[model samples]
Target: MKTNYQREITKHIETNQLSYLFIMILFIVGLIFGAMIVVSMHFTQKQDLLFYLNQYFSRIDQQEILNHFDLFKSALFSHLQYLIIFLLLGLSIIGLPIIWVTIFIKGTFIGFSVGFFVYQYGFSGLLFISAAILPQNLIVIPVYLFAATIAMIFSGQLLKKLSGRRFIRFTVEPVSQYLIVFVVLFGFCLLAALIEGYLIGYYLPLVRQLIN
Candidate 1:
């Protein structure tokens, strides 16, 4: 059964290779654009951002105990909202462009975050991000990318059906399978939220010490 599932997944990717490539490239383009935005920021703008970051760090230091549960709830809620958008967009035939925009925006935020860290503290910035950001994003990034890709693919399928280009495989999998995939993806999002909430909170103090 596992073998059959793997084969089906492999076949699915093979069939949608072009869509995956296009989505991946779109995300990369967003990342580059985000980095460029960092480079182009005015000195004052950079300082303002840096000031805010410092204030955040100071709060973390001053607090005797962080509310990790609150962090988990916030992260999970954000992930849920993002996934809900993809789910709705996947159901709509006109959602293709919006799905692309969503992926790009996600990439842009990630790129901007890493760019800001590296720009501010050099190697220490890299260390801080690796500890603070990369842990959760290691799962979160792929989850978003896969969700976006599948959403686009499903949207495309809906378009084909509307255009009278129906295929047997479309009928075979149907909306149920598409929805199942999103549900499974959401489970991964849950794991990412845990990492974001608990693991990152644990790591931040260490990262703060290293950077300081």
Candidate 2:
């Protein structure tokens, strides 16, 4: 009887595996699509950053702008932190659409930033983004996707519970898993930021100068 029960449980898990896999795949696909949208927005908002920079240069001294780079980077880091936290919390409360919108917004920002670079330097702008943006995104996107997947799964389980599914054991594991993933995600984000600040910020400018 025990062996039969074990076999049945294993079979159930196996049957449901595809659904979980599909959710994960959707998360990844959503991320890539979000990135592409952001890249597009970058192109659309091409002159925005340069215009702001130009105005700053006109008003402020050149040395001031250079000196403020660290401040600017710090502000960006803070914003990213807030955005991550907000999105994670929001995902837990709201439905998947809310999470999707959050991701889309991120993608739009990436697109706008990339577009701005392209506007400033043409193809060379791509290199700037590759150095600065790619490194952090490599860490961040997967984390977001995983969080989104977990949230969606949790929501689905909640729905199942609501729909009179007595056999389903809806518990705290999903939330706990989400918290663990969130911590890991933030750690990766911190590492990515460090790489961006140290490696990309320090070396990429030199590379650009060399290429130019």
Identify the leading candidate in terms of TM-score.
1
The residue-by-residue lDDT of candidate 2 on 15-102, one tens digit each, is 6676456555655555466455545555445467557755654433323333335744773586466446544553453465665555
Using all chains and alpha carbons, the TM-scores for the candidates as numbered come to 0.93, 0.61
Please report, in order, the local distance difference test score of every candidate based on alpha carbons. Answer: 0.87, 0.58
What is the per-residue lDDT of model 1 for residues 28-52, given as tens digits with 9 covering 90 to 100?
9999989888999999999999999
**Candidate closest to the true structure, highest lDDT:** 1
- Candidate 2, residue 165: the lDDT equals 42
Query: Model 1 clash pairs?
Result: none
